[model samples]
Target chain A: MMRNLFERTGEKTLGFLQRLGRASIFLFHVLKGFPIVLTRPKLLLDSLYSVGVLSLLIIVFSALFVGMVISLLGYVTLVDFGAEQSLGVLVALSILRELAPVLTALLYSGRAGSALTAEIGLMKATEQLASIEMMAIDPIRRVITPRFVAGIIAVPLLTLMFMVVGIYSGYLIGHGWLGVDEGSFWAQMQSKVQWNYDILNGLLKGFIFGIAVNWIALFEGYDAVPTSEGVARATTRSVVYSALIVLALDFILTSIMFVEV
Target chain B: MTQAYIEIKDLTFARGQRQIFDGINLEIPQGAITAVMGPSGCGKTTLLRHIGGQLQADSGSVSVAGVQMNGLSRSELFALRKQMGMLFQSGALLTDLNVFENVAFPVREHYQFDESMVRDIVLMKLEIVGLRGAAQLMPSELSGGMARRVALARAIVLDPALMMYDEPFTGLDPITLGNIVTLIRSLSKSLGITSILVSHDINESLSIADYLCVLAEGKVVAQGPVEVVKATASPWLKQFLTGSTEGPVDFHYPATSRANDFHLEAKS
Candidate 1:
């Protein structure tokens, strides 16, 4: 029993290391193809149009609702302690710290990440990647690079939009409907919030989340077994795993950022 | 004897626990058509993939056009693949790209040719496949034979030294099959390229194959010139060539007892 346990543990460790190695190689390819992405404006524009502009409404709506709910929750709890005026501060902090980046990433993963994996997976299944390779073209440079660069460029921009819209929606709900004074709401937010730390940390989280989403999508697509069912499975796996990782990384970054302060 | 352009030495491949090809040895001579014919599930497509460098062998060597394929890097193998052409069973054209773009794909991706040069090459290849007027058509718009021809044009666009056709005549009417076979023969000869054809259309393939190989149970049961393969006494080869229902191939079906059970159940 002990021998079997040891063998299983060793196998698990080896598998983990192998996955890590593959991820590093994928990252290396993505980095190497960055220049090609810059040179190809059409590809970049297309990806931006797909990943950013098409995804704007969903991200904005989700963020607004999320912000309103968080503000309501903070207002109810603070009212119990006679601190209802702090709702603006609470909403601003939550939007910047947690809700905005995570919610936007989840929405983006569903729309952009699933599409990326499916498109690439289908290309692979049809041997289009083989054709590309046969033509001495680097698929990473031609196909993967544009998607990765687009994700990196798109996610941060989307997250910023999410934060702005979310915070405004929260303010509208709290001050306009909830009867909080407009003058005090802005005062409370400006006094209580640290812009540098909150904005920088959120942007950092967005960047990492973008990388994680694209990495998972590209890896799943690249390793996609060639079949109709296999491509479907890859698309689902990419979205699920990327969303999970985005949430996990958000928690880690949030704890690290606030714990020191 | 024609010089062996693509050589396989003790090639073997296994998928997980199942051995697909075991110690398979074959040579495709230069400037001639070599047809690999086998029953379904006999690893014919796998052999074509091996030659195209899509699948690697487990324990032996495969060399094409003086390049050792076993130890080459992925990029090196890709470079070698550029010198060869392949016609997939399903045509495998990119559905999103139109016919012109599909034919021009390899050229545009590989070479930095101007638009005029790319257009000229694409039109020329399409013309060779008798698809000059259908350059703007989508794959969905084309028939099976037209798609196959488009695939053929894409395959030969770079003027590859070797061409591998995987089931070129599959799922086609007799007329289309005949035309494709004729095109295969005339194009390979005129282009002076060695071709390896994997097909189940035995009679048609035999009409075109200068050299023929018969695979059964992961091994070469018979191989030689087309006339010699036809004269072989191997019962399996005879059954395959003659399309016999009662022969070595009957073993592929379920046991007689199970077949009898089905009949009895139908009667009851």
Candidate 2:
């Protein structure tokens, strides 16, 4: 049993290593396919529609709810310290530097990342990628790079949208409903939220999260074992892995961006 | 004998634990439709992929147009692939693209063809496959036969010197099968495209293939002109040709007797 256990563990480790190698190669090809991304405007536009435009409604709603909840909670917490007027400061700092980027990515992973995996995984299973290869067109350039570029551009824009909706919803709750002073809310937000340090870092986190999410998604899809079951599992893995990586990366980025240096 | 366009020498391949091809050697003549026939999982599709450079053979060589396939660079392999085209068993059309764009894909990707030129060329290829009327249809909307025809149109649109069809006639109605066979024959002849067809459908292959190679147990057990392969009395050939279940190709799985499998106590 010990021997069998070792053998199984070894096999899984080797499989993981091999997949890591393939994923690296796939990523390199995608990066190398930058030329194609620039040259093929139609591909990028089409992917933008699918990845960004299609995902608009969900991003909007999730942002609004998250905004409302944060403000309501902030109001409750601040009231105890006689700091309810500081609700705007608290909400802006949390949403701009942390919640907005991370949550938008998590949602995008569920929405666009899984869709990417399913679409490309099905294409792999049906040999559409191979068909493109047999046509002498690089599938990296022809299929993947545009989607990668679109995702990179889309997620950050979506995050910006999320932040806007979240802030407004916070206003509706904190100022309109909770009877917090509207002047104090906007004033604290404007004064406390540093544009360069806070907002820029948030957008930067969104950018990085975009890369990490789509990278995992596209890799899983392209490396899907080319079966129906394999594609389905890959789609599931794409969401799971992208979410995990985005959250982990968000923590790392938060540390770096918020550091004194 | 015609000159060989594709030459495989002492090729060997394996799928994980099981060896699929062992020292298989065959030559396909230029401009002739060569059919590789065997039962399912006999490396027919694998052989096509090997020639297409999608899979690397473990040993020996696969050369098309005198280009060694083993160590070619990515761009070189793609250059080699540009001279060849393959029709997969499932048609493998891009689901997102309609028939016209599917046919136009290769031309659009490889060349700077203008919209008018792209449209004209795509329409012509579709017309050749009798799918011009289906240009607006997506792959999902196409019937199996129509999808295959569209795939064929796509494969030939680039005018590759070599055309490979992997089971082009599987799961088709007889009329559709006949149409495919006629199309394969007529297309190969008119376009001077060397063709390799991997299939189990004996009637369709025999009716269309110019040369024949029959594989069994991971090797080419019989190969010659169609007439010669027909006359050859090799047991493997006979088993394959006659579709017999219980000859050299065993009907039973390689397992113990039913009594032993069931753990019978005694045979009273």
Candidate 3:
């Protein structure tokens, strides 16, 4: 039984390594298609419209509620120390440094990423990809790369949007609803939130999460089993895997960027 | 006899444990319609893929138009594929695009023609397939036969030297099937292109085919003209052509005797 356990572990490790290698190769091919995709601007624009524009309402809606809750909770807690004036600092710092980038990525993966997986998976299932190949066109270049570039570009922009809306909503709750001083709220947030440390790093984190999410989504679709059930499973895996990767990357990025040496 | 356009020799392939093709040898003639027929799951589509260079042989050669498929570089293979067209079993039209755009796809990919020229070429192909009026319709709006015709227009848009059809007659009404049969016959004659059709509709294929090839057990068991194949002495070939259950191809699943399977005592 002990030997069997070791053997199983070894086999699982090898299988994981094989998949990792294939995924890396897939990324390479996708990157190589970048030049071709750039020459055709319409493809990129269409992808942006689907993945970025269509996702705007959800991001804004979710960010507003999250920011309000954080502001409300921060106000109640800081009142104990009579330090309720620092509510802006708490709200701005949390939204910029953590919540905006992470939540936007999670939402993007659930919405745009899953749709991408299902679309590509259905294309494969229906032999559209093979037909593209028989037409002497590379499906990777024509289909996958545009969406990949769009996702990467869209995430950082969405994160910035999320940050703006979140901070503003926090202001509405802290000053408008609650009895916080407006001057202290703006003053404390401006003083505490550094552009380089908080905002720039957050955007960078968003960019990295974009790559992870799109990579997983595209690979899952392209490598799917090409059936209705297969596409469904791939869509689920794309969202689930991307959410996990985003959270894990958040922890690692926070440790590196925010942790004082 | 016409010169061979596609030649497969000693082709062998297996998917994990199931060997799909085993030492199969066949030749498709140039500018002629060759029908490849076999029972379901007997690798008719697999043979077409092999010829199209979509699937590589295990230890053999698949040469199309004198170029060995396995030996071409990626760019070289793609260059070759430009002169080849394949209609998938599902019609495989880009669902996102309308009928006009689907037919125009290959032309757009290969060249930078003016909008007018592209429009003219697309309309011409759609006209040939009797779908000119349906150009603005989406794939989802099309019937199965209409979708297949649109896919056929797309396949032939580039005027390829060779065309492959994978089960093109499947899942069609009798009228649509008859229309497809006539369209394929006329297309082959007018285009003067080598055509290989993979289908289970024996009568439809034999109606248009200049040659017939039947595959079973990973080999070509019968191959000749339509009349020759019709008069074949091979029981498996006869069984397949006539759609009879009694033949070497068993109707029952391979298992122990029924009594043994039921756990009954053996009769002495």
Number of the predicted model whose lDDT against the real structure is largest = 3
Kindly state the number of residue pairs that clash in model 2.
Answer: 0
Instruction: Kindly report which residue stretches of model 3 are placed more than 4 angstroms away from their true locations once superposed.
Output: B262-268
List the candidate 1 regions with Cα displacement exceeding 4 Å.
Answer: A1-24, A76-85, B251-268
Error of 1 at A195 (Å): 3.1
TM-score of each: 0.90, 0.97, 0.97
Query: What lDDT does the true structure give each of the candidates?
Result: 0.87, 0.92, 0.93
Give every collision pair in model 2: none
If the candidates were sorted by their lDDT against the true structure, best first, what order would they fall in?
A: 3, 2, 1
**By TM-score, how accurate is candidate 1?**
0.90
DockQ (CA atoms), all models = 0.47, 0.91, 0.91
Model 2, span A150-175: residue lDDT tens: 99999999999988999999989999
lDDT of 2 by residue, B38-91 (tens): 878889999999999999989999999999999999999999999998999999
> Each candidate: RMSD to true structure?
3.4, 1.7, 1.5
Q: Highest TM-score, which number?
A: 3
